[model samples]
Target chain A: MDTATVKKIAKYLHLAELEKREVPRITLQYPELSVEEAYEIQEHLVQIKLEHGHNIVGPKMGLTSQAKMKQMGVDEPIYGYVFDHMVKSGQEISLSDYIHPKVEAEIAFILGKDLEGTNVTIHQVLDATEYITPALEIIDSRYENFNFTLPDVIADNASSSGVLFGTLLQPPHKLELDLIGVTLLINGHTRDLGAGAAVLGHPAKSVAMLANMLGRRGLKLKAGQVILTGGITGAIQFEAKDTVSAKFAGIGSVDFVVKE
Target chain B: MHDLISEKAARFSAHLEQAELMGQGVEPLTSLDPQITIKEAYEVQLATIQKKLDTGRRVVGKKIGLTSIAMQKLLGVDQPDYGHLLDDMVVGNGETISFSRLLQPKVEGEIAFVLKRDLIGPNVSALDVILATDFVLPALEIVDSRVKDWQIKLQDTIADNASSGLFVLGGKPVKPTDIDLTQIGMVLYRNGEIMNTGVGAAALGNPAACVAWLANKLFEFGIILRAGEVILSGALSAAVNAEPGDHFSARLAHLGEVSVHFNPV
Candidate 1:
């Protein structure tokens, strides 16, 4: 991967995220962009955040399902770091923080132990988890009109922006994880519905994917971090002042008022 | 020899002693000093474990976690990881464990190897593992994270004592030869309802292979699996959530069953 390309793209995406601006897809500028290079761009972005005094809280996995993998022509999921600035848990999110904001419901895991290595499993994920919660991830892609390839999106931190956590924290043992149900509501009306299985068969596996990815990088999922598994349903675009809530069958619900 | 890594280990020891939360990720500690390598992560973990040992915690055996393909694939690894099991981490079968004592725990169903002979490695193999084992019994590892929110990586888990929390032994014990280690099956139940199921092949082909993996890994640290130690082979099924007022049980073919109750917190 070209280190200069990673720095250049990281700068573009970082500033876009800050100034709430949209830019042309990087692949258009660098058609030769590859998946590994895209992730390198993402890694640089994480460094940029850390340098700017923003902490890396945890990681989020994207494009986990086979359908998305097939759509993107990739065999695995992409990941991005969750920043402290990218959250509004149970609070109102100002639309001004983003450009053409959209939302997705996800299952998030808070690990109790460090989860990483080549041999991590969903079973081990549960063993490492502190609690499981429902999440509402607010995304505003830096790419113009959100038109980007898998690599392009990966460079943009999988379009991840803000997150709102559900208060209901359930230990993994008591819940039927595979059967966990999710309902997305917008402005007091139902918009989408899915289940934990929607996230790579089980949401825990998505987290396991993160551990493995980090493990390969010689990085482990750190303890005291939070991870938002990939979206449970397709992204739903919404406008300012829309009251949106995502309800998990057993883990409870998290809602936020989106306003400009 | 960065102060940050060693400093964090001291802080980690304080947290584990009180069953409290670890303050921050060790990434910053390593990031601050490039001299720190992957080897340092294990040292930090060992430092914390040594604190527990200094306070009178005795090592009972060890555990190999993440032995399944899905788990190995998820962590991008081709092998499992190991952690020390302490005497106090053991939970008596059919006993009610206080939920408050644990910092967000999940229970995994696995086979525990009660060894009758010391097995040292670097040269350890599955055949050696089976030969040294005295009996195999069903057990549940109550894995907990003192690191707040459990946002850990392999380094973090390794340093955090393999995330070993509490464990339980079952009513039945079977010899390693009594059952085909790879062919044995298990059913996990939560509140009298079946939740998940799996076969021993999930533990890296054969559950004994996990024991071998552990022994070999420990050899890097000049450790050996001694007689009378009980090693927890990786989970036969995915770990399940544990909550107060819940009765959970797991039964392994030929190995009988183990049960635990989480008292309301």
Candidate 2:
């Protein structure tokens, strides 16, 4: 697609999310869209949000797990801009603000030093990450009926609507990056389970992928940005009054409530 | 109702196994239909595998698809899906495959596992897979899409038997103890030109881990990995398009090289 079309679709998607409504997938019109084209649309959406006074808080990695990646035939992780309004912690989310909302438990990484350049290794990511905490990603897909392609998801900011992180923080050296486990509970019932290895083999890898992926476009993850590795356990649908808590084995628990 | 989904799923399964084209690639089945849940997608997959079993096709092993990050992006699939590799899907190395039999064919390199004992698990670990006592061989998976233009969703591909076409296995077998599977590297050459390069880390950190994942995933359907199976543990890199007269070769560090040729349809 062209720049004009990309910007138009991005703006339309941004507005659709704000309006708390659904729209037809863009792939219906651009079936031949490339990954680069989709990423361009996403970057443009971030720029539009920035211009509208939404700060670029950080990036969120989606489709990082090999199981999920292989499940979709996509080869790599895709990143979307996380705006200031999207970040939250132990706060209630009104269902009116989203469409078809789902939730996944995950790990959050806060960068201590700027990570720049391509081919950033896991070790570099570990050294750069200051703290690791439990997190929950509230995904409200903007596409109708939760039906979308990778391109459609990318254009919609990886379906990210809200984020919640626990207050407990552990230094990188004090914990096993790949060994952290989480249990997602809905209304006191265990809904899912996952390990840090679920995110592209390790949570640190997500950070490294974020840096390298951004570095390709002459961008870098600055110090003190929060990046949520893709969902660890599978995503589950949540309605009003549903309470969700992700109990991270070594870290702590992050919880939130769905409200009308 | 569940009956409606099962009906459509059974129809799609028969069409795939019989090499029948359900429709052209213009509209994806997932996009066209709405009743199919992600859970039903797996049901469709199992239904397809059961159909193969009824047709006298022995299950040789399993295959894990979309192992590499670069591969998932290339195929536009976001997660891993799997398929059963019957005794028939295995082609010997240097074999000249007739192109007319395949639909929208492509090729990629992989590691093949030959097992020694039956393994079943809901919580199988990578160590369990390693201790199963098996030899590893180099392979080239010939992937074809029945869905036109390969416009597939995760469910669509799963229901389509993980987009399985065929795989060629070669090279001397090396015991699992001989090398660190994660560090094993490979270079795929198409028509004697380098096409892609990757390592075993692409397959969920190690190819054996793919088996562990497959076993654990299959447990959900009450299936088991029997002894004496040959599994293709997913591609090492992005797949290269295949054409008539194309020669594809993959060389692995410790496993040697595997090659497959294409004949005119």
Candidate 3:
């Protein structure tokens, strides 16, 4: 695709988000835009935000689930950005700024050592040791009436909306993770069950992959940053006026209520 | 005479305010056609969102959808999909969502990452992921779509913000080497009863691999994952439906837990 066309598309998307309204569809009028073209537009969009006082925070990985790939009919994963404006403490959430949103259960970690650009092993992730916590993420979209495609969503930042962090816990070294269990409750009902192993068989490995992924981009995982390991239990759909909570066996739990 | 002009202006102002309010409150629109090629529609949809970012809207983070193996097969694909997040979509945990704007909204349990350094793409290794990250936390991702009943193709989901909605973050931060993530177990409790159970392996055989995949892919585009960014890897299990007054929770063995609640609209 032409650079001008890419910019035009980027410009339209920016307008639609600002209006909080959807724009009429535009025909690409060409085959798929080259990856470079797509990213060029993305870079311009990033700059536009910086000009508006929005700060860049970090990068997020998408499609970490092999199962999700099989469902999406793709073999590879995609990614997007996380800005300063979207992050929030678990206890301080406002109700008026979001559309429909849901939460997930996950294991979170902080990087204690610098993971430079290179192949990272699980052992290294463990050697960098710090502490661990639980977390919840809230997602909302900007599409008019909230409609979009996979590519559209990717370009839009993987629908990352809000996040919540939980208490920290560090188990004794050499402890077996299979002995741990998490209980998820929705509206006073048990909705799902899972363990840390559900995330690609191990959450640290997930961290390891993140380290290596960043390395290729000439980046490194710094100390004191947090990373969510992915869902351990299944997801539950939510509506206005609902209360949800998750409890980790022998650890802690996090909960919140939805308001109109 | 003077009063007449003032009255006319007042009426115009009222009308404009009403129009804007009405427009702002309208439900999200969805195509009536089921046969629309999701892939084609996604390309167009992405272009439009990019336009929004180009103008002023900010890029918040990324979201992963359908991390479950069942979902992958349901869409007749072999891998997970992704989408973007804007500054405006985030909300606190336990916040009510406007159903009117979403076709079908669901929830998932996931792990989220916050990076402390810049991460570029092109063959990023798992070690790089460890180095780039600052903290890892538990999260709940709300998957909502404008497509009726969450009906969509893989491409459709990719465009629709990866069915991204809202997320809640809680818990303490730990270093990657602090625990054995592969053997991590999770149990979900809704209200007071058990609902679901899973492990981290469900996320692309290992959530780390997912990170590796994302890094290599981004490298192809010359884009980099900067420090202090948050990434929601993907769902670890199936999606659970939620309604008002419902409470959900997920607990990870050794890591801790997270939860959210819905209230009456």
A123 Cα displacement, candidate 3 (Å): 2.2
Chain B, TM-score, each prediction?
0.89, 0.91, 0.78
lDDT by residue for model 2 (A135-186), tens: 8888888899989888888888888888888998888888665545466779
Better of 1 and 3 by lDDT: 1
TM score of chain A per candidate: 0.96, 0.97, 0.77
Model 2 misplaced regions, further than 4 Å: B1-265
lDDT of 3 by residue, A33-125 (tens): 444454455556666667778765544445555555556565544445556676675544555546545566766666677766679887887
DockQ value for model 2: 0.02
Candidate 2 structure quality by residue, lDDT tens digits, B52-126:
677788878888987665557766766677887888887889999987768778998888888887788898887
Task: State model 3's lDDT.
Answer: 0.60
Residue B115, model 1: lDDT of 96
Give the top-scoring candidate (lDDT): 2
- Candidate 1's docking class is incorrect
**In model 1, what is the error at residue A260, expressed in angstroms?**
2.0
Per-residue lDDT tens digits for candidate 1, residues B1-265, read 1224477567644544444443332332323343544466567667766766778989888988778767666656677777888888888999999876777788888889999999888989999999899999989888876555666555556666777889999867788977677645566778976666555655776789999988888888778789999999998667787888889987665677899999976
Docking class of 3: incorrect
Candidate 3 ranges with C-alpha deviation above 4 Å? A2-47, A55-57, A90-95, A144-149, A169-180, B1-265
On a 0 to 100 scale, what is the lDDT of residue A196 in model 3?
59
Worst 10 residues of 1 chain B by lDDT: B23-32
Question: Between 1 and 2, whose TM-score is larger?
Answer: 2
